[model samples]
Target: MHPLVRWFHQLGSPPYFDRFAARWAPWCHGIGAVTMAVALWLALFRIPADYQQGDAFRILYVHVPMAWMSMAVYLGMAIYAAIALVWRIKLAEILAMACAPIGALYTAVTLATGSIWGKPMWGTWWDWDPRLTTELLLLFLYLGVIGLYAAIEDRRQAARAAGFLAVVGVVLLPIIKFSVTWWNSLHQGSTISLTGPSHMDASMQLPLWLMVIGTHVWFVGALLARARADNLRREAGKAWIAETA
Candidate 1:
């Protein structure tokens, strides 16, 4: 078997994943925390303020990462959901379920920080801009998945149901991604791009990139923590838990 295939097979084993998550969670969290602090320091103290937005632009350090994570997490969830539905992989199901609350939290953070930033610029707490509206819908979709899974009694059945919803809701992800470009909106265009030069100064962009990487690292720790807890609960009667404990 290919090395990558073997690794994935190992990952699907509950005991292996549980042990891996236990060992790696702290490292992920520690690195993420330290990186976030450095990013915050650079954003708040080192980087020059925007000429137009001034100090108000500092909020991007938080808001931009949260926004990016919100969509990235959902896309991840959808992929896991697809895997679970196709192959009935138990690990995939747990991962898909675990992603919902984390994604929702990012979505909430994005909304809150966006609102705070907007108040000074747009002179309002909220606006029904295309980007904002689609983002709001993304949050609702996350909540819907969480609620639907909880409302069902059987774990497997609930996972399937929620997985279906997650798969269907993927349509919204593209909408959220393109809303700014597809329509006129109060939101600005992308500051970073893969195919084009960034529109930001190198100093400003460095901290934002650090924050984005830190957010994703932190999310891995959170996801592992949640997946472990859920695995224990779902396997409360299993022998592996006793052996590991």
Candidate 2:
């Protein structure tokens, strides 16, 4: 086999992954902390207010990143779930299950911050905008996965059932992402794109990028922490677990 495939196999080993998670979780957290703090400072203090939206626009620093992560995490969870179902990788199952609560948290944050921003910008606390409605549905999907997993008695069986739900829910992700384009909506078009010029000025853009990157780094740290706990619970009968304990 190729060296890359060998490396992947090695990384998939539970014990190896546990050690890797232990070693890197703290580093990711540390980096996430520093970046988020710097990003907040830049967003709140340095970036000028939008001439049109004024100070209300600063909320984008929080809302956009959380919204982006909500979708990204769901996609990631579905991929992990697929791997668990197809390859029967225990780590994939753990990771997929772990993703539920975190994704839900991001979804909740997105909704809350979006609402807060909306009241000022749109003069209403809520609107059934296409993007907002789909985002709310995304939250329900996350919660459904969590509820289904908790309702099952056996961990492995629960993961399988929840994985199926997660895979099915992947359909919601595209709907959430494309709602702005597919329908008339209060939500503005995306401000940043990798393939196109950003609508934001450089000052505002840098901090938003920093926050986005930091949010992802923080998410990995959170996932590793949750996955580690899951590893312990699932592997309680294994000798390596006792040794690590």
For TM-score, the strongest prediction is 1
lDDT of 2 by residue, 72-112 (tens): 99999999999999999999999999999999999999999
Quote the RMSD, in angstroms, for model 1: 1.0
Top lDDT model: 1
lDDT, candidate 1, 1-245, per-residue tens: 99999998998888899998999988889889899999999999999989999999999999999999999999999999999999999999999999999999999999999999999999999999999999999999999999999999999999999999999999999899999989999998888887999888876798999999999999999899898888888889789989978
Q: lDDT of all the models against the reference?
A: 0.94, 0.93
How big is the positional error of residue 19 in model 1, measured in Å on the Cα after superposition? 0.6
lDDT at 69 for candidate 2?
A: 97
